[model samples]
Target chain A: MKNRLRLLAYPYILWMALFVVAPIVIVVIYAFGSAGGGFTFDNFSRMGTYLPVFIRSFKLAFEATVFCILLGYPLAYILSKESSRSQGILVLLVLLPMWMNFLLRTYAWMSLLENTGLINKLLTLIGLSPVKMINTPGAIILGMVYNYLPFMVLPIYSVISKLDYSLIEAAQDLGASSAGVFRRVIFPLSLPGVLSGITMVFVPSVSTFVISQLLGGGKYMLLGDLIELEFLGSAYNPYLGSAVALVMMIVVIIMLLIMNRFGEGEEQAVMI
Target chain B: MRDKKSRVPGRIFLALIYIFLYAPIIVLLIFSFNSTNSRTVWSGFSLRWYEKLFNDDMVINALYTTISVSILAAIIATVFGTFAAIGIFNLRRRWQSPVLTLNNIPLMNADIVTGVSLCLLFVASGTILGFGLGFITLLLAHISFNVPYVILSVMPKLKQLDNNLVDAAQDLGCTWLQAFFKVVVPEIKPGIVNGALIAFTMSIDDFIISYFTAGSGTQTLSMVIFSMTRKRVTPEINAVSSLMFVFVLILLIIINIRSSVQDKKLRAKPA
Candidate 1:
């Protein structure tokens, strides 16, 4: 039986090994090699060239994450507080657009933010100056929020929905004010969801290409765009792109590990 | 707290969010019928864009390509993923979590990084072997990206299965494969269906991976939309998007309805 099970496990394990494990291993190996020569530390040595790109990507990702948290938390709280029937409707509303294509949705943002689009027209009608919302950092941030807000809300909603209401009442009955009740009772309980949501939003937004390409325009040089330009553009340098990709993987792995540890700790705390 | 004033802001926020999400869709639908090439102005509604969309041979080719790729990828990924999930269930406890995590890593990795890395790998392979990129590259990329999602979706159902049925089937002299086919599959068939649905959607909706992997003639629907929007916003693109949205909405509703009906029948079965 055990031998049969082991045989059954072969195809799955091999599939993952070839696709997930092999591609990343290839990246790490290329990251250590010189572009056109023997093995060297040249890739790592030139890290200074890419440090600003990392910083900019990290900053934009951080800002987008913060926006997701702020917008997603209240929406989650409201959904959690509602009756399950209405909550179902709310969840559907959030997920419907999510099921559509990501590129399509980003294109939708382009239409909405265009100078002659609806928002600008509305602004003109109200006698306000037309603001160039498209192709700005603000547009990138808005696009991030629009794409990822559902991801943030769902996890937090799962956490908040399962929260014990009696805990809030207990705090209130002990003369805790509204803010105190929230801080002491609600926030701590929902930290797992918050952490997971932030990780989800941050990791993807950090390396998203289509959004930055369509909405951010070529004006901005995100890490994703840089990697694309090197790997796929006129510069056809796979070695450099591989190095950048490896660095991104390492950073994201670190973040995910941190989030996992935090989540585990929070779970233990909740159990206690 | 349940009173009117407390609910007011929440109601407004919900409304605003709905508007934010759906307004683009509404505009896309409206503009699809506008006679003007520029989508913003009101030049009277007509079916001209729809007519043009049908006549465009490139659009038709892209639609065919996108549908074929998604369907093929969905089937292969679902089969591989389901087998993998079952195999993982039978694995030693110590190795299971890590293996699962390894599989999930693909799901979490950024699309751009994955696309670039895969493109490089294919380029290297093609250079070494003297082959050109085409449908095979596209399929492999789709399968790699989709298998993880399928595993994640179906694993939970596999975990919930009762072990006794398989044991009983084995005791009745059924072969292992027979037992698995007769006992295990039917129990978790819903998971397989759900996993396949998700894979289909993800494969169809993917932009970055397809962009990287597709050849000049193998453009998908999303690639067409991307190129069109870059050139200029046209009512034809809007017509396509609105149609795509409605198609997805209908699919979602049908899936939900089918599952609910199945649930009802399951509940009526003998305990």
Candidate 2:
């Protein structure tokens, strides 16, 4: 049986070799090699060009992560406390938007935030001045929260659902206040889920050009935009694009390492 | 006693969050049927936009491409991912985690990066293959991204399974192939199905990857919708968006039903 199964695996081995393994191999090689002439340090040396973009993308990602955690924690707690049937419905609600196309979800925000859109229409009807919600940092942040909130909510919910309520009760019996119980028990127990969600949101938000480009209207240049410009825009510079990609990868690795450090103590709490 | 007032505020907070989450989608569905072109005022609801959506040839082509790519990607991902999951399980226990993580790289990496890199690969290959980027390249890209999800889903089930069952089947004089098909396949079927469902969703919902890899002729529904919204905030898009919203909603319901039934059956089984 094992031998037969091993034989069946060859097709998948070939598939991964051609697809997942090969494309990444090409990128890693090209990241080191030069663009036109030959292998050189030219692309690596031009890292200075992407410095501002790295900062901007990282800062925005940081802001989005913070917001997701803040909003998501309490919501997840409530969801975990709900009955199983209601929890299923709540999960479906959170995941439904995720099933819709990313671009569609982004456009939904566009409809909401456009000058003549629903929000402004409502504000004007209410006798308040219409606010410019599109093409701004705030709009981009709103889009980020809308699109990425599920990542935060799902992991935290998973952890909270699996939490042993008896531990909380025990803490309460020991005369711990509600806040104290949360801080000492629930919070620490849920940190792994929090880490996973944070990583999920942060990585995408930092590298996401679509939200910043569509919502911020190209006024805000994030790292992904910079990479896109080099590769596809008028510049058409693959070398510089590859360099920027490498830098982005490094930044993500650093972010993950930080998360890993903080997550070490919390790994015991992983619910999934 | 103090928790009662606190719980009221918590309930209100939950209500507000639900309102935030669902309001945009509700607005989208409502405006899709608005009779007037303007969104500010709602005239009597009509189906004009839905009619227009059917007549748009370009939109039709995009939907065709999207469905085609998603199906092909789902099939390929399920088959390959199931095989890979089984293969990794047959290996020594210690090697599994790293192998699993390696397979997950394509998932964890940013979609835009994957899109760009796949574009580069296609661009490079088109030179050798003498075929410009189109359906084939798009399928390849979708398969690459979808496979990781399949693996992630299937591996856990394979890990939980007992290996001795397969060995015992072989001891009973069944051929290795027979044992694999009759024993191993049934054990992991749920995981494989779940993986395929996720792959289907991911393949259909993906915009960034599809945007880069798909040529003009192979543009998916999302690409068309994206371009349309960029140009004009038309109600036809809303109509199509609402349709899509309903389609996914139904899919979610079906998945829930299947899962609950499976849960019941599993609980009924003796451990």
State, as a TM-score between 0 and 1, how close model 2 is to the true structure.
Answer: 0.93
- What lDDT score belongs to each candidate, Candidate 1 first? 0.84, 0.83
Candidate 2 wrongly placed segments (more than 4 Å):
A1-4, A7-11, A32-35, A44-47, A265-272, B1-4, B171-173, B263-271
Model 1 lDDT tens row, B120-169: 67766788998666788888999998888888888899889888889999
Candidate 1 similarity to native, TM-score: 0.94
Q: Which stretches of candidate 1 lie over 4 Å from their true place?
A: A164-178, A259-272, B172-175
What is the Cα-based lDDT of residue B51 in candidate 1? 91
Give the alpha carbon lDDT tens digit for every residue of B144-213 in model 2: 8998888888888887889899889989998878987999889988889989999999888888888878
Which clashing pairs does model 2 show? none
Q: Compared with the real two-chain complex, what DockQ does model 1 have?
A: 0.67
Q: On residues A138-212, what C-alpha lDDT tens digit does candidate 2 reach at each position?
A: 888888888999999999999989988899889999999989998888998888899899889988898887888
